[model samples]
Target: MSLTSNIADGRKKKRRRMKSDSDISRPSPMQSHIDACVSFKDKQVAARVTSDAKMDEWFVVKVINFDEKTKKFEVLDEEAGDDEEGGVQKTYKLSASCIIPFPERNDPSGTQEFPAGRNVLAVYPETTALYKATVISTPRKRKSDSHVCKLTSNLLCAYLRGYLLEFDDDEEDGALPQRTVPFHKVVPLPEWHRQRDLCIKMRLNSEFGVLNM
Candidate 1:
């Protein structure tokens, strides 16, 4: 009777543990929706991921191609200089993580969802506006991988939402103008490519173009 009782207690404990595990297996509602959208879009991005699963700061992923018809985003690894000698080009496929909602108007709380977060209007004043940005990061092929392939502005934007501001270079000493254009812009992003000459170059339509950002 004693042995039987002990065995029954062990089974009860195992059942409790299994219940806990099942609870953890469920994904959040928002996360589940985001996953569905990305899976539908078939998009991807890249990032300089550390071995310990941390993202480096101020990196950008250049979007080489996008197919609106197919609703997919194509990404490529940005490289520096001419590799007259052969070198491995590192790139990843990614999809949008979330769906971007249409802009809202006349809300008591004015928050845009695109650029996202607070702009550093004045370090002294400390005023901000909120915005929302849909970000994309690549997933590792391995099922048990611990890290995402890229880091994105989604987290920062969420934290700083409703406090976005713009900085004036004229007022700032040694401040450079911000780039806002795609391909020509020098905005810091998740996949960064550094060149020794400080000249930014991109390949568009099988041709190389250089721009000073």
Candidate 2:
């Protein structure tokens, strides 16, 4: 499948038009936390980037605590923004399921799937260099020590391509390729918020449709 399907120019890809689910897979990181994450999906909103430039690194953010007053999840932003009266604020309101969790693959194999647990979510904007997102939940280790970290759509693609590229290089030179390792980490969102945009960009890709892996 081509990576340029729904991408419009260098800045936009409409999710409504995304018609493929081929890229969706159950990577190892989400094996333990999937159920916990599904429980919070309806209460979150995710932000992602459309440009390839922003997808190079990982975005780690903290999930906003559930609110009882407005009955919506609130996200914190390190970037300053102006209010209607021009006051600076660092928080925003997100719609339900706007953010969801995905598992990050470390040493990803085309033949394995992990059990579900907790995950984080983010949103992808139309014209940004990277997807913007907020962390939705803190990871808690289960009895089996199943811990998972979600990845942005761009990151997932990058990880696969990068590994493949390296493998190809080794193969062409008549050398055995090294095993591929997953490029993901499990960290606290609040601690990593200012470090990375802390988000993911994803759309359904028909070529990588949801495989129960």
Candidate 3:
């Protein structure tokens, strides 16, 4: 065999070895934590964008697709309207580290649905801790009710009519005050609250603690 032919054969063998090593080092799809939680066509969920400088900002998005091999997702941002001329919608391809699912209550069918008057825990903007609140109202597409004169001159009420939230914490005299907050800022309570409320309800039931007589 010629010397050039032998050199070419050696180079081909090295390339094959490198390819085999890469395949072995690659992580399996099942091993990815992001793939386990993500599902295509899942209900829209609130996710905080961590990849940007504004990490605290949250947006509602639906999972369009999941790349199990890459452990990434293609999400459709419902809040971000399509471009003019009805172009492509606002979508993002982000890794799990760049997104976090918000705490939300899901129905048995895996749909996130919250109705008005539902009790929830919400964090107001610039607040560090969650506060007990009730969903008084959600934003409507049409203005059904006529605007009333403000009892007090508050600039917030003048411009935007946000989500109406009634705080569970009341005054010493038992007066609960309601405040308007942006919808994205509000989220469902943690799991601990749900379990605690369940226990309290069971304890109050008549047959809960009755001894067998």
Candidate 4:
């Protein structure tokens, strides 16, 4: 899918009466009790989608459509020729748990430039799969002349400069070495995880009487 097609201006389109899928619509009671959270229609975030292969590989997808009533999402694979045979981008209907949302870039917790040692999901080199990576360096500005998008030459010159990342699974001596991934291909963790983590930390602090200090 084209970038423009994937990113809309937040104007609501005509609502489609989505039907609830029995399997994905409701989370198990135990799962709900483990972590109760709220869902938002306004969550503007990209998603990491498991490929058709289900081989632990994924591609970054925008234009996320979540149906709270059904607890499911309709995500578009923005990668060109991502369809089965290589023609156009493909769409997938998946359960809520299947979609992993990226944190908003405007979150007050951090800026687009993630600090060194920050954990992130980044696209592996020459592949659509995303992997956990540790930021070794902040992004640097770089120039580009690629005409992939419909932008002026001057405007296109400022494509993102990928930061240095050491993938988590690369602990072995001959694993994929540290590499760079453009800003567009990297993203922070979802808000739900961040909230849960903070809550856990606070609970631990309270148990230790650290909060009373």
In order, the Cα lDDT scores of the candidates are 0.34, 0.33, 0.58, 0.60
lDDT leaderboard ranking: 4, 3, 1, 2
Most accurate candidate by lDDT: 4
lDDT of 4 at 163: 68
User: Between 2 and 3, whose TM-score is larger?
Assistant: 3
Kindly list the per-residue Cα lDDT of model 4 for residues 169-212, writing each as its tens digit: 77667775778877656777556545765897899988889657
Model 1 residue 164 lDDT score: 25
Q: Rank by TM-score, descending?
A: 4, 3, 2, 1
Question: What is candidate 2's CA lDDT for residue 156?
Answer: 38
Q: Say which candidate scores most in TM-score.
A: 4
lDDT of 4: 0.60
**lDDT tens digits by residue: candidate 3, 100-128:** 45432321123243468877655554543
TM-score of 1: 0.25
Clashes of 1: 26
Candidate 1, position 54, lDDT: 30
Q: Residues 1-213, candidate 2: write the lDDT tens digits.
A: 356753554334444335233235444454334444435433322332112444432332334554544444455544444576366534555433333333344433332222123222222222111222222222211211112123434323444432111221235457644332222322222323334433422223432355533
Residue 68, model 3: Cα distance from true site in angstroms: 14
Better of 2 and 4 by TM-score: 4
- Weakest 10 consecutive residues, lDDT, candidate 3? 103-112
TM-score of predicted structure 2: 0.25
Which regions of candidate 1 are displaced past 4 Å? 1-34, 37-48, 51-85, 92-173, 181-213
Which regions in candidate 3 have their CA more than 4 angstroms from the true location? 1-113, 141-160, 204-213
Q: Candidate 2 — what's its lDDT?
A: 0.33
Error of 4 at 57 (Å): 5.2
Give the per-residue lDDT of model 1 (tens digit) for 69-109.
45444544444324763565544444442112211222313
